[model samples]
Target chain A: MTVEKLYDAAGFKTISKGDGKKEVKAIFCCDMLSIAMSKAPASGCWITVVSNMNTLAVATLTDVSCVVIAGGVAVGEDMKAKAETEGIALFTCEEPAFETALIVHDLMNA
Target chain B: MSEVKLSYTISGDDFTRAGEASGDVKSKLKVLGVAPDIVRKVSIALYEGEINMVIHAHGGTIDVTISEKEITMVLADHGPGIENVELAMQAGYSTASENVRALGFGAGMGLPNMKKYSDDMNIETRIGEGTTVTMKVFLQ
Candidate 1:
């Protein structure tokens, strides 16, 4: 599945940039649990972590495509720079974590 | 490939560098060319152990051994020994102070998550003494 497919299912109104047709097969959406669960994505997981700099660390380790911050999750500038430098996608949404998880589920399953 | 082993000291006082050990291990696993899933499993388990050491143990040391067939990790902390390992293993059960929680930790998910990710685990601690955790993740 492409990032656009996930965005549409997640009801994400805005996209960061340069996400044309990148593909992902799995998704893990949550906060702090990114420490353990995020890294355990089946394969091709585009994790959605709503934490701060820590999420950046998980993205680097798990080789995620994009990290969608659910419900307008926010992070500091350092985290943003780390994500950019690591070449990981960072996005946000207005829906809550659970809702975002559902959307991610449908997208990955579809 | 040559039975790589790395060790690091985790400082509880410095929340800024909590994940440093995990980061190093992650990169090491990457260099070893481990499968992404295996690397992730090792890194997450070790990362949780690192956080637990930083939070509960005041500070601790982690030793990681990686080979062609397996990854082994040992986290030793002299902070405060857990009184009840069973209760502590429960999800949502955390002894983290409010201060630690404020730093986005102490969620009570550390040990459980570690056990969930690792193929084998052993935790030994004495109340008021210290704690040592050993976990192993096998490569397929």
Candidate 2:
């Protein structure tokens, strides 16, 4: 599904403007930046609770389609700026990471 | 063949800046038209080393050399060196403190991940003196 569709389905608020039309290849759920960087599928959506500039860095390096920060985590301003600069798609939601992951998984499987 | 060299200082506990060097190298390699797999390999290897330097060592210096056939990264640090190189290299062995673990790292996968991605890797360390890691990724 496209990022826009996923955003609506998962009820996420966008922090960075990625190509909303870009198709997501898959969804990866992890808070560890190293493991995410090593294992996340390129062009997939990353679901995590860690809200930091490093989150943006990992997204940029791995070329993820979007980052879904779950659990109502308040991402810092610096991280938002970095995400904007890197042209990475970053979003946040009130739902927990596991719940968001489930929604994304169902969407992908649907 | 001509080569490009880059260097950066990784400050200790500076989690925000940990991946800066590797990101720069990845961008340069992409601009140089290096193969995707090779670029990914070098980026992953170098970033792991950068994280290690930040958490274990009190920061360090990373020097990268990019040639037509290979990319070489040399990371050197002046901190408490590894007490057991063999054990440290094991997949699930880590000495990082709880604080480091909370940052979502210290999972004992740093060195092993670095080795997995690099074509060649070598570690030179002295318990009190320091540690230096050299890794190379071949372009094929």
Candidate 3:
């Protein structure tokens, strides 16, 4: 699913533009980078992380479809530049990540 | 190319800042074009180690080496050593305080999760001196 769809599913508001056409393979919900890495599905999945570049770094390494910063969001200039360079879409939302995940589950199921 | 080595200090005091090292490693591996699955394995294993450092060790140091064939990570801390290594390795075995559990960890899954995500892992400890964990994840 596109980042837009993900937000819509979670009933969250977008903070940045995202590639909404990106298809998602799986979803991960956690603030910890390691747990997310361990639990998140393989590439083609969408990851909702609560951390900053650190989370993006993990996403880049894992070849995720994109990263959606759910609740507490922080993305610095360096991280944005890196995400752009890596073709990793980084988006932020107003709602918490867990709630957003519920939306994602609904959307994916539908 | 030869194996590339990286090291970082893990702070046990800050829960919010715990995953910084793992994040850095994941990004570095991504930029280097390591396989995605291999990267995940490293990320998960190292992330678990980072949490362990904060929750149990108070802080520590991590050493990571990436080669064309394998990735190795060694995490060392001067915190109280594991009293029961075998039990700690269980999926539900945890000695983390209640506060840690409220923070979303201390569920006793750290070591088990680490082993599940890593190809190989070894742990060494002194009840008072500290604990050392060695983990490996392969890239095929």
Local error of candidate 1 at residue B28 (angstroms): 1.7
The TM-score measured for candidate 3 stands at 0.73
Q: On residues B25-116, what C-alpha lDDT tens digit does candidate 2 reach at each position?
A: 99999889898888888888888999899998989999999888888899999988999988988987888888777767777889999999
Best candidate, lDDT-wise? 2
Per-residue lDDT of B1-140 in model 3, one digit per residue for the tens?
58899999987778756677887898898888987777777877788888889989999999999998889999999999999898888877788887676555665668888899899999999999999999989886
Q: Ranking under DockQ, best-scoring first?
A: 2, 1, 3
DockQ of each: 0.29, 0.67, 0.25
Q: Clash pairs of candidate 2?
A: none
Better of 2 and 3 by lDDT: 2
Task: Name the fnat for model 1.
Answer: 0.24
What order do candidates take by TM-score, descending? Answer: 2, 1, 3
Candidate that beats the other on DockQ, 2 or 3, i.e. the better one: 2
**Chain B TM, cand. 2:** 0.97
Please, what are the lDDT tens digits per residue for candidate 2 over residues A61-102? 787899999999888888888888877888898899888888
Measured with C-alpha atoms, the lDDT of residue A54 in candidate 2 is 75
